[model samples]
Target chain A: MAAGSGRAVVGRQGAPLWLRKLGSMFLNVYAMAGFLYLLLPVFVIVLFSFNEPGITRDGVFRPAVRGVRNYRWGRFSIDAWKDPFKLPDLTNAFQTSLKIAALTTVIAVAIGTLMAIALVKYDFRGKGPISTFLILPLTMPEVVMGLSLLVLFVSWGIPRGFLTILIAHVMFSVSYVATTVKARLRGFEWRLEEAAADLGASPQRTFFKVTLPLITPGIFAAALLTFALSLDDFVITYLNRGPQVTTFPVQIWLTKKSGVPVQINVFATLVLIVSVSIALLGLYVQRRRERPVAD
Target chain B: MSNARSTKRWAPWALLGPGVVWLVVFFAFPLVRLLTTALDDSETTRRLGGGGIKNFTTIPKNYGEVLVRTFTYSLIATLLCIAIGYPMAYFIAMRGGRFKNALLALVVLPFFTTYLIRTIAWRVIVDQEGPLVGFLRWTGMIGDSEGLLGRPISVVFALVYNFLPFMVLPIYVSLEKIDKRLLEAGRDLFASAPRTFRKVTMRLSLPGVFAGSLLTFIPASGDFVNADLLGTDSTLMIGNIIEKNFLKEQFRPGISALSFVLMLLILGGVLLYAKLLGTEDLI
Candidate 1:
């Protein structure tokens, strides 16, 4: 049991064995509790997704009272799941979020993947400055990014709407995509392309056959991440979304003044399920690809 | 050979062109333009043009309390993250056994949910009719009218919760990198377990703590949602102020200045902390 942590020494150092056991036991319990703390809110969110608002007063259901939020169990029902698009603002905003996230993923991944491949595949002038530039956006606060972009759009006389939001999402997402793809590119074998060339394959053929397949997983992972980032974005999108546009998070913020809607949780739960599924699918594909290599 | 060499010369630029241009135009240029906007006068007469530096000059005095509170909450949240996250990270890295990947995935699970949705959940948990409020009422901590949702502690708790994974992941990476053989070497040298942890494990993980602290603090300081949803007017953060002012056209210059000042302070603080820690590689 002490093999991993090297706490095996405490027993040898005149400390009683039981004391060491108790310490390790305590450490494990603390970690378990920490995980619980981290996950509890998410659990609550899922649980309340099925909550039918307004306790069954006699036979009819009603929305919870005005001052207090509907937080009780309130009888488990799939009303939210059945009517996920019950709120117009939320549905429209969610669709817009998905659209922007999709467009942003495509553009950002294309641009960033090329950059990452170039950076890894070849050394060139201005590499250091370019890398540093990429880091700046990642480190900058979303508030700053949002405000700055808003300023830029207003000054440029560009209307703030779906286009502006797309630009903002793509702008912020590029560096993350770059960083992820770059990290993935680092572990790739450059020799394979060379080997293909030596075997009389043309450069394009070498790329398609040797490099593309090996790099797809990284690019796919980066795309998934970019999509997630774009979808979950609130601060940046809110600032740049303007009067006409709204994303899911922005909708949630706007609706906060009114009341909590069950549809928000239902959609949120759906998103969670989709993202987790995609992640698992990615993992499965990567594992399956590696299995052949292992054999 | 000449043709291939030319392709080499142009290949990197060709690939880097779109991303670089996009960042410069959309990211870098906006920030520069934001600075000018910050320096612009409060009057809408010349809203598009640059003006005097009074926005910067008056921000400190006007927003002093908010500036201080933002840093204080972020600092406290960062400290709490290290307290909670470090042990969890250490345990998982050292003792997670075969369940390591699964546990790590679980840690990242909440991130799949939208940020506002997760925050909304916290609102439910601490609202007037929630379990936490019931518990606190039972404990005689407060009356039924006094809910848990809008308080300093709730704000800080949400901050810690939101950023705890950021603290944990980096620390876990650092802890995982601690060579097991070295710990064995410490044992062979007759160092006790606690001493070994203090000297080797703790010292080696400073970089992780450094990283985790920055991750937790930077976002926590700039965070708007946790404070906005969980706390009332008295606990409103600089981010909430930034959000409000930016939305209101009359306050753009002042808010721009505030945003610029906040960015400057964060950069300065990070540099100073990194310098004090001698983590020169952080840059």
Candidate 2:
């Protein structure tokens, strides 16, 4: 009886052990493939960045395992790093991007926060429609939105220029800010404001002291997101920007169309590092907020 | 003292005022103006108005091919992104632990670069001399590099790469919202892993799946960036065509028609997505 029971146990365990091994292997393979898919383009760019003569037999940039000579050469040449500046046009574009990004962030965040507060904190007429209307740009294609703005600007005799591009960016970015801020406010407790009112503090003073302080982080987050989004904007800016008002992205577009340049890769890597750092830092903060406090 | 109530009453408006003014100036006005210009165009009126669909009929005749190609590539690229992105999202959601943040970060990191810069990166990498060609040759994957680019594959790859995060993020959000307890309950009820996933996980993840699909499909369908960056003349996207007419002073009426149709198509897709996810799932 003991031997028979032992044999039964062994038989049952053997199949699962083998199956488990196979399952784990399959998962590992899948995970590896996904990692590769995520990293492939980045890896390709980084690898090509270091590959030099950097030119192929066809006089075009190609990847070769030819070592670190290209990196050394590019690093040694300060002018190569300053190529965007040398274009004069490129420097103007960069400054234009900065100014537009700054303006768009301020305008979009302020409006979005107010709308979010109103919609989330108080009952109002036509709130649903208001929300939907705000969300309209989020769903519309960049091309459609860009073209729509272009037509509007031209028809109004507004003249396509920096101001138009800035407005268009703020329009698109405002919705995103409002959505996120409203989401953050959903977790807010209104009883604090009620308590302040009950304790003889006026609503205006209470809100200025309490409400703004609590939501400031969310406001900041929205601002950062809007700024990043505005900085990288291309479609609307491209459509609405006047001949003399090219932004960094527009300049890059023209340059790429002319032919590929290595400096763009260097610029891209820098942009990637900065933007990703900001996004990941935000995610980290969110994660920390979600964790349970230990006694 | 009474100013408190007055301030309280007007505070929300004060908050909402700047945003509303911005939108009215930038968004609403622009759209209104665009429609009027198109409708009022003498050329568009001359071509299509006299007994036809008016301004609308003129668009198709002028930009039919551009419209068709744009939708074709967008639809194709969107489908491919879903096919590629879904499995990847699933793997990350289910299997990721300590590595989840890192992996998600990788997905979003590339998007930080300007669109033009990333597209230019591909231009460098996919060129005749770029590493992709070199790697393919080294690995015996292709006999030559000439056929690899200026083709739909390169454009599709760029689109997929650029938009993959949009697809993944929405689905990841949806997937994370799924109730883990229900998953455990399925297991406790003696359901097999695959069966539980099929019955529970898949059903609940539909909203996220739909959101991701819409996010990817809308932009991908309308995108001309990849086509412009990676394609030859034969592969112009709808966006490129519309852009040509709008900016480069070519095929004016045709571009307008194509733009109008593409907008409708986009609206249709958004409505469909809303229907699938219900209106509340809209992000």
Candidate 3:
């Protein structure tokens, strides 16, 4: 107990720092290793994109040679980069994924923003239940949601194609959009609208000029998130996708049998680049917004 | 005045209408449909009302192994995520003074790539002749007969790898919110560092832990991709079984039954967890 008090005095004076330093150092190493683990697959994907086309042996293009796996960086080749669209249906699938994602984002953001507004700005009957119900889709597994939707479509005699995929995407994406927008709305003050109203702005005019501008960042973030979710969705898309429609993820899944083309890496790399750029841009904007307040 | 008051009362409903209706039709309706279909016997008819309670009862009798494996794998994966994620989250929260946002971004950046592609990259990394395998072989850890692929370890590793960010983010959020002054107070009280961490830090971070574990465990349980890509036939999860029943075997009723069971189990686990953590409002 005496020793402990002595150490506490040293700690209070902020001089007994070795333990804290040692702890932080250890934490830094662990954090670095964790980050490396997260990035290892990404590095492998990008690195192997430059690998030479697998050689065909006995009418089969083997990805790796004997005693060496296909993961190795063999001879560097620019063939994949030169013709990333080598696969026949790759572009079609990419386009389909983009269309679905865009449509889903727009529709989800429209409905979700309104729902978020309602949940935040108004007190109403069934509000608690509605909030809980909205979160249900997020908690449920993708496979269950997909299978159930498939059943619904099949039973309703609705042809399972782009339409069904769109419906399913919107279904899942709304919850996300609403959640994101609601988070943003939580920090918002409704009196801004009231102030605008008192300043002679019409209800619609206040919303468009004042409220919408304030919440635009959240809406934008939500839309981007929804797009990413829709684009990368596999399990649900796989189950709901009709025989005719194939999204990029479904195409990639199918390619597992035929051997994943190097072009898929190229596509994935592009997606990574686009998403990172958007995120960095968002960070920059947020920093800029916070700077004035800090000052 | 009365007319305006009524409009104000209905306004929230009007705002919530489209999104709620869409969810009801696409989300809630499908769940109800799934329950009905699961209870029905598809062998007799494609429509509902033939199987009764047999579908639910047959789950434990028939696919019990798959159900157990799914939870087991998910549980193991969630624990692994916590082990790997907690330290990293702690480091960023406590020590990442100026670069906290940048560090957090680094954690999330890898998720920009498609999840499937990332999992596939694991296949390459753990390939028979891959570097990881080579290293293991060099250390004489794995025999020539023992490979990383087609093993339970690889599947769980893939799951931990993929869903780690989900675990880290929530924990980071909770940990970062913890006031540093509380730690200082504990220190000022002459509490040892480990004791302070346990009593103050860990206790305060329970909500994040609960959220992170749920996020990691739920999806990991439902995921078939890791098991399909990394594991052998022996490691097939309930997800694989459901997928097979739906897509391959074309057994709709059976798939529905399995899916219903899986959903119930997850929902029950989540409710129980939420109750224990007293974090119903956190979600």
Candidate 4:
């Protein structure tokens, strides 16, 4: 037993083994706890989606009294899931968010792709300054960005509405898309394009057939990220949106004062599911692509 | 030859045109306008033109407490994030072995959910009768009647929770880059485990530390949602003030002035941090 204990106490590097063992044990516990902290809120949000809207007293949904609270388990019900769109304004806000995200993704991806290509493929005056200037918006606080844009819109006589919100979303998203695409273009081989040109391809054909295909994955990734950013945005959208326009986040902010509806959780769960699916799909595609090269 | 040369010269411009123009018109122009708006007199209602610099004087009287509180809360939150995040990052980078990518993905997965929804969950978790409050009360950390929500501690806790991943990922990136041989070298030289960590590991991870702090600090400082949901009237940050001034109160000039000053302070902090860290590629 003594010999066995000694053998177990020795580490690979022959250092004092108790310290390593203790340190690693502590670290593993800390990491697991941290991950739990990160995931606990998400789990709670999903779990509460199944909760009955509230205790119904004689055909009336009675909310938990303000100061008096209950930690008891809520009865399970699928009513929220069954009628996810029961709240008309919530649905409208969700639709508005989707519209803004889609439009922002399209416009930002187009402009950002061009800018990325310019920065990577060509050298010109103001290239350095322009590259640095693009990062400025990212470093600025979201509140500052939103406030300044509001001031600009008011001064320019542009009515603050869907158009203004769209512009703000695109403005913030373009830098992100550009940065993503530029990082992808870095270390990319120019020889492929050169070879295509040498093989009797026109400039447009070379770009379409060679360069575009090579960068499609990066472009797709950037678009997905930009869409997520736009969808999740609150600060900028809230500040700039007109009374006529309301996105999902703004709706949540407004509704929080008057007891958040259960359908909101249902909507949030759906979004979480969609985003996770996209991420998993991206991972699957990446693995499939990498497998070919590895083999 | 001249035609080819000219085409090459103009190609970059053509490609860069739309995006650069958009940024200039929307981003750059707004910043300039904000400065002018802040400095312009508030009494001149329709003056889209210009006004005197007296509008700047109102900032100290109106927003001094909020400005101070904002930085203090942000600073405390940043410190807490570093404390919690660094250990997790170190563990993953050093001991994750085959599970490294999976662990990193787990860190990022939580953020894909809606930010406000996650914050709202905190409200539920820290409710008056919630398990967390019960645990704290049982542990003698708070009075029996006291709850966790609607307090400064809750606001800061939410901030740390929301931005912890930002701190972790950067630190993990830097920690992962530290060669395994360096740690082995330290051990070979008879340095103890703690010494090895302090000198070799900690020294090298400063860049990540700097990056993580900046990422956490900047966003937390600007955030209003956590404070709004988890805090009471007296616990408002600069973001809450700016939001109130911009939206409800419709104090445009005051909002602009407060925003300009906040941006300048953040800018100064970032520059000073960059200088201290000796890094220029932060963006």
Candidate 5:
């Protein structure tokens, strides 16, 4: 309980130095176990993505071993990765997911960034109600959000499909986008814009020159988060995606019902790779930007 | 002056307009519509020919077991997240040194994968013929007939696994923000290290725990995917019921009612929790 970085307690402690170090080691072990538990599934998913599933005569790539699910490790093969989009349904679903996620990111980030800026900078009428209203979606259970939206489309007689999925994705994700951007916007110096304006910059020029660049990091971060959420969204997407529309997650669920496809693992690993790569790239860019300022 | 005043009046709305409109049409109105859907009672009357609020009332009587089970399972998951997440968050915040951001990223990396797939990975881990269960069976720890799949503990564990990052991040943020100088001051004031930690460190991190608990609990309680994919019908949750009801036409009222009950219960619980924790700022 008392362990920390400082040597003050270390020098005064009755316990031996090794024993004190052992206490910290316990925390380290506990943390490693926690991380192991956290990453166990990711490791499984990635490992199984590489597993060569037994192709049955009917063309389904489940485990060849009878009476068991396709999760067991099979002979090592990269067949799934080599032909990642083997299933027509999987390809179609992946395309649809990518499209919705992209569109959702663009729309949510734009709307959320603007809203966040307004809330942070301006004393708008009904700001309280608006803030609470935006926070509502974040608090609402996703199932409720999906069900209600599903019902809304039904009651409104709007066809549930690609557009509905887009709407649903944008709806749930906008708040998250707003919150992320808002957190970033909170500490921003509004005086920068005023200073630009004072230097004879027009409102439009001042915003473009001063404000936009300052908030771009926040906006970028929000967009990345939104893209991930939109891409991986299943429950709401399931509710909104009519029979004709299928996203990656909905396809995975459908596949789960039929059989666990090795290709499913393949595509999922792709998603993990793509997202992690983007995150790393973003981190690298941020680090590079800060280094110059630090120097 | 009038032009400037008008621009000021219209500017914020211009910024807020599209997002607020989208939220109103999609987010806010649907919830209001959900309430009406829950209480509409048209379907209930058509079938049974009598029952006003039975849509809400009958749920407790009919599926009370499922409802209770769902709450308890998620509650246990939330508690587990705190137990597991706190130490992990503490380690990263206090001891991670230069590796904190990387550690946080690792914590969140699992989330980038499809939520369903993550649960499926657990499904693999706990399969009847899978290594873990096979080992357990071999050791006679569990009966040959007994399986890990479809168990309540499995579902709870899935929730914990899925939501652990949420709990950890907030706690990490809070812990990282704590000043080391405070601990030093406690040491100087003749407080023992353990006493300093209890009186200073943990006290400051209460808000994080409060936030993390809500973050873990709300979604876990409402989540159906973990229960659906991991557990059998014997361990169904309210989310499964809501999902089922959403599918069939006759179960419309039940769908909304069950969802409403879930929202209400969660809201009430959060309020009670906030009160107990005395974190008035959150509410």
Candidate 6:
């Protein structure tokens, strides 16, 4: 205690001398600056969205001091939010995105879960090679993957549409989900399953009743992550989506081909908020469930 | 075989069936077909092979220029991510309190947002009428409309901004996993703080750095989203060329060969990175 307090005294006495503690603090400050850099453009976009002047003349967005009139309130109105179908483009895009995301998430999670189970529960030939093959898609560039899928579809005379989009999403997203579930399975004990079987449960019942509940968190994480990946996928969707099938990202990309509107800023903020909120909520729920183990 | 052996034999296959089917159909099939076409399409080979290695060569041609530009842009963006992200990762991992998870969550949240929307948003912020331009002009930094977004720097800046979290999160996880006692031990030996960091912290965190850079570089190198919205036609990356081939040009054979070559290059780099980081288990 004396030594601790004495060092505290020494530290206090040397407060004016940062030479003793220069590098660490500098690194900390440098890191914070980097954080600011990372966040600056995003925040600026959100900020500038409110700067709309309701009209553009001579290629200049006349600055309006963020009055309610300056907000594209009626154009991108709350009515559209409440009844999305009123705006056919947004509604169609939203519905398409939801359908694709939901299907992709379900397929990815189910397939990934089964693979994780087999990987953990059995020893098989070519296991190492198989695992590598499974993980390859996750790291592949989205554009390359998108182009390759497009080529195969064209070659095989498969028409590009909703089915193609969903298939492509599931193809890429399954790898991520599989890796997540497999990591969860790695440290899981087999005794619980044995105990269930010992108590007269069949293998399927044992898995459903005991093992499934334990691994559900990982499965849930996988689903949510896949949903985001599916919704956000542009490269693949851009390549394979039929002319009539425009998801939100495709719409935004097309709009970018024209001049950008400030409303895009508003929409982007909402997207960022929604995605961040869902991820955080999912993480919060998972962490709450995990607290007991951590303790 | 007996019934017991049959049941046991099919169980693992039953479990693995869906995943294997999914990969074989969507991944392996597509790659096989694309590569076969790239090497076999009569017209493509006739054109490309006549030029020998020169056709596949990554120079002189506009495609070659685009590839080089892609490498240069991604390399710059990746370096910037490391320079800007490592410190941020260190800050959140070492000194942040209960808010660390919340902050990290913020960093990753952008990943969930649509890439198209994010890139488009940057366009609005940097447009001629955008506030960024106004602020710069007001500060007398530029007198003309051709300011931030009109230049390569802004394109690189936007790429760094979008991809920075990829660089930070992996490093943050690695840093968080490091033993605190090791750092304390370094300090106990009366080494200066910088010395301790260089010898202990940086050495241990190298894996995370490699992982983060791999995550950033691979995506950024192939990314066309930022280049499209933030860059001019001259600044397009390899992804833009791929996008053009698929969409506008419809040069399937050239695009396939380009894609195949690009994949090999990226795979080689990732393998090297994994080796450097001493992690052979990378997917």
Cand. 1 Cα-lDDT: 0.87
Model 2 agreement with the true structure over A59-176: per-residue lDDT tens digits: 5555434432222112223333555345576667778888999998888888888889988887655678778888888777898888877776666688888888877888899899
Per-residue CA lDDT of candidate 5, range B1-283, in tens? 9999999899999999999999999988998888887777575444853245777778878879988998899889999999999999999998888998999999999998989999999999998778899899999999998889989889999999999999999899889889988988887776766788799989889899999999999998889999989889999998888877787756766688789889999999988999998897875
> Candidate 4: where is the Cα deviation over 4 Å?
A1-16, A53-73, A293-295, B42-52, B248-250, B280-283
CA lDDT of each prediction against the hidden true structure? 0.87, 0.72, 0.87, 0.86, 0.86, 0.75
Please report, as a residue range, the 10-residue window in candidate 4 chain A with the lowest summed lDDT: A65-74
- Name the regions of candidate 6 deviating beyond 4 angstroms: A1-16, A20-25, A44-86, A259-270, A283-295, B1-10, B43-62, B138-145, B248-250, B275-283
Q: Residue-wise lDDT of candidate 3 within B117-148, one digit each (tens)?
A: 89989998888867899899889999966679
Give model 3's DockQ, 2 decimals.
0.62
lDDT of 3 at A274: 91
Give per-model TM-scores: 0.94, 0.85, 0.93, 0.92, 0.94, 0.87
Clashing pairs in 4: none
Off by over 4 Å in 5: A1-21, A54-69, A293-295, B43-51
lDDT by residue (tens digit), candidate 4, B83-146:
9999989988977888888889888877888899899889889988779999999999999999
Badly placed stretches (over 4 Å) of model 3 are: A1-23, A55-73, A293-295, B42-50, B248-250, B278-283
Q: Residue by residue across A1-295, what tens digits does model 5's lDDT show? A: 3444455445663456677578779989999999999999999999998776554456555557542245667557888889877789889999999999999999999998889988998887799988888887877779989998988998899988999999999999889998899999998999988799889999999988888988888888898889989999988998888899999999888878767788888888888998899989999998887886653
Number of clashing residue pairs, candidate 4: 0
TM-score (C-alpha) between model 5 and the true structure: 0.94
How good is the docking of model 4, by CAPRI class?
medium
- After TM-score superposition, the amount by which residue B92's alpha carbon in candidate 6 deviates from its true location, in angstroms, is 0.6
Q: How well is each residue in A104-133 modelled by candidate 6, as lDDT tens digits? A: 999989998988888887777767887888
